[model samples]
Target: MTNSTRCGECILPDSLPGVNLDKDGTCNYCRDFARKEDRNPHLSADERLRRLERLVAPYRKRGREYDCLVPVSGGKDSMLVLYAACRLLHLRVLAYNFDNGFQSARARENIQAAVKTLGVDLITYKPNEKLLDQLFKLFLTRTGEFCTPCNLIIQAAAYRIASQNGIPLILSGGSSRVFGGIQGVSQSKYADRAYFKNVLQGHVDFREAKRFVVENPWKRAVRRYTRTGPNLVDVLDYVYPGLEQTRDLLEKELGWRPTSDELEHGDCVLNPLKDYLQNRKWGYSEVTQSYSSLVRTKQMTREEALDHAEEEETRQPPAVLESFLNRIGMSREEFEQTKHRHFTEFPNYPQSRWYRMGKKAVALMRKVV
Candidate 1:
């Protein structure tokens, strides 16, 4: 969209390829949030902490001490959960991470430092790289979506670990919009396990999910075959902070610093892959739309998140992009042609080569336009 008519408060406008503005001088998304919030008051930090404490307390009984399982990536949000549980609430935490095949060394180092600094027990689960790479390409090129499967695998493993260890609660750093807004009813996208289960079911087969995780040799040998025989932990039994509140506490109180390469999605290296696939699958970056929506909704300041979005835009290196495309066996010609096709259709789904790819790609690509 044209800069002139872009929302006075945010970096979105009608000129945004497929964006629509509302009478309130905000985008339709911003207006939607405003309406949602108008209906309810947002939760406060104390309330959020109380909710979290209540969730964690039952598991922290005298004989049983572990409070929760936190899925961390050494990013701002996960660290937010880490520090809040240990430093703020004084609860025992199990810091869990999934070493997806594509993580940056810096991210790995950050994870180590976070574990050491927080003095929390760290548990890592890594899968077979060869199979993961194949799956990544198949999902990205054929399905045009890798995150749904990747996140499901990680979450499944993390909860299984927690359940095996008898940790009754699973805490998540998903409270960004729930407490960030000043008005009633904060804006956010995270929900409970049922929601996530539905999300996973929509994309992948539950029976096949076990196969995907077992395909990882390390996990199969160390985790699956071990005594911990596939445990399922309850997810709703925990509290979490909203994005802004969590960031503030983590950086200010616990000395957690965000890595230089983090995007609006935080320090996950898988983000570049997500951005690439989304941008390729659709004409616009999902981060652009998601962050811009956060700005428009006033959950985050337009200037702050927009700058983060722009900064993230520049962080995608040419070499990494080239490597990812090459790894996926996608030719530059095919990639460019996809972009051209999407732009030409502009706001319409381009299904010209529909028969060539699989059903997943057709379905995921259709969601974008």
Candidate 2:
């Protein structure tokens, strides 16, 4: 494996696809941040609160059910979202937890604590474990990521819940602007419907694929026409008070506790396995992107980010790894084989050259317009 080279200004490494370093060793991401800063200064806390209040005012107590649906994984970020929705904005919230049966004990504790303390109704959803296991095994053997199924199911459930409950707003913790930089090369591969179908076709039978992997087309069509879908709002975009400020607030007000493991992935047992494989293949993991975000935002120094990155990227919890492998019915020997497989060998699902170029063009247009 080639040694990774990082941006001089931030921790975004050269190993990431589409990251280019200029003569100063600063990456394109840094330049983009600079340009964005010049065009739009950061919003103050008061301004953020005002904007949030305005956004939530129309939907507050609109129905008998709930004002907003906040997806919480018991992470600090999601906790902050719940806090703001309940304590600050005074919006009635329904906390949704999409459990894949890999939730950490601390995470579960935090989730229960947050909902109980905040007096928000809580709902937990888990997909069929047998089908979920088959899906994870398929993704692990076919591509490098097993989180694909989890992400897809989470979104689908969120959409379904919001539509069924008539919830107008779905508030999430963070956004691409916050953690997009450090994502590994595997992100470039498309994991849309076509990609999932192709992968399932190669392994599972048509009935199993239809039942487990595919979303109901008729339901989706009904949602589209009825305007029952909830509008997603990333709370960070409006009210990010930096990592330290958030942690302090959560601790003092909500009795929040940090997990014993790395705070980057919260309480998911499968995250370490995913990070390990990504680091093995691409020379970076979720830690890089997260700390890189902090560096770019000036919440953390590049040196400190580098130190944290080194520790997180190289370390994997043994117990979590073992549990994840056993759950997916894969042996450590099979996991080791994945290290030799490159990301490019997998089918690029949603991302074509033209698609990437179009995204770039759209971003540029948004900035200029």
Candidate 3:
């Protein structure tokens, strides 16, 4: 592990499963980051806020039940979006939270406090517990990773609720600068319905598909673009005041509290376990990719990122691993057998080229708008 080659800029290593390094010792992920960070033409803060208003205005029409739907993870970014929707834009908001059984207590507390204080309505959804546990076990055994099921649900639920309630907008708290993808991992992208259904083909029935899967988002994106359906906008892209300032506003204006729960990944318990497993398997995890992104964004210097990376990568594995295993009815020996497996070993249902094309187009538009 000590002899492994690493990206000159980020802590990403050549040993990580699918990462490819350049002759200069930088990885492809870093190159992509540099391209987006350096070339994108983003709007000024005020114009950006105006951009948000224009995008949201159609949904904020008179007599609308909700001006927009904010998916709350009880995290800082979501809280910022919720605050902006209500206080900043003067828009009516509905908050949605999903408990996949791994939500941290502190996160739950924050959600309760946030919706109550903001005078917003929240819909908390917990899918069938027994079935969700089964799905988690299947993911861990088959792919050596388990976040996909919940992640898909989180992304899809907003669309589902918006569709059902006649809500015209879904405001995502996702910040590329905050929780952006690092890529090159098994299941690096969220599996489409085709992929998810294919995985469940021989293992489990897809009868409960509606509870966990989202249909082709490209089609959804088209609907959004044609101005015919709900728009799942990344609201933070328009209004974020960078990390520290956002945190200050979260704490001061909304009474948001950072938990002492030692939680990471938006205070979700499962992420620490994933970080631990990735370190054991590849000698590093997405934590390195994530923090390295912060370094590139100048949110943290390379020196600080290296130190923080080591601390996160080296910390003792949390007890959640055992608790998670217990809840999923898996034994330690079975868990050990699954570690060497990767999700890429399984077949991915072919993705639409249009989705990729449309995503690139939207990313560019967000900046130029």
Candidate 2: where are CA atoms >4 Å away? Answer: 176-178, 181-190, 205-226, 315-317, 340-369
**Which structure is stronger by lDDT: 1 or 3?**
3
Q: What is the TM-score of each candidate against the true structure?
A: 0.67, 0.86, 0.88
Is 2 or 3 the stronger prediction by lDDT? 3
Q: Put down candidate 2 lDDT per residue, 65-132, tens digits, no spaces.
A: 88889988887888888998998888878889989998888889988888888988988999889988
Q: For candidate 1, what is the lDDT?
A: 0.55
Best by TM-score: 3
Writing each residue's lDDT as its tens digit, candidate 3 over 12-35 gives 778876678988988887798888
Off by over 4 Å in 3: 186-190, 217-228, 260-266, 314-316, 349-369
**Minimal lDDT window, size 10, model 3:** 258-267
For lDDT, the strongest prediction is 3
Q: Count of backbone clashes for each model?
A: 11, 3, 0
**Alpha-carbon RMSD to native, per candidate:** 10.2, 3.9, 3.8
Residue 10, candidate 2: Cα error in Å is 0.6
Query: Which pairs, if any, clash in model 2?
Result: 182-289, 190-349, 190-350
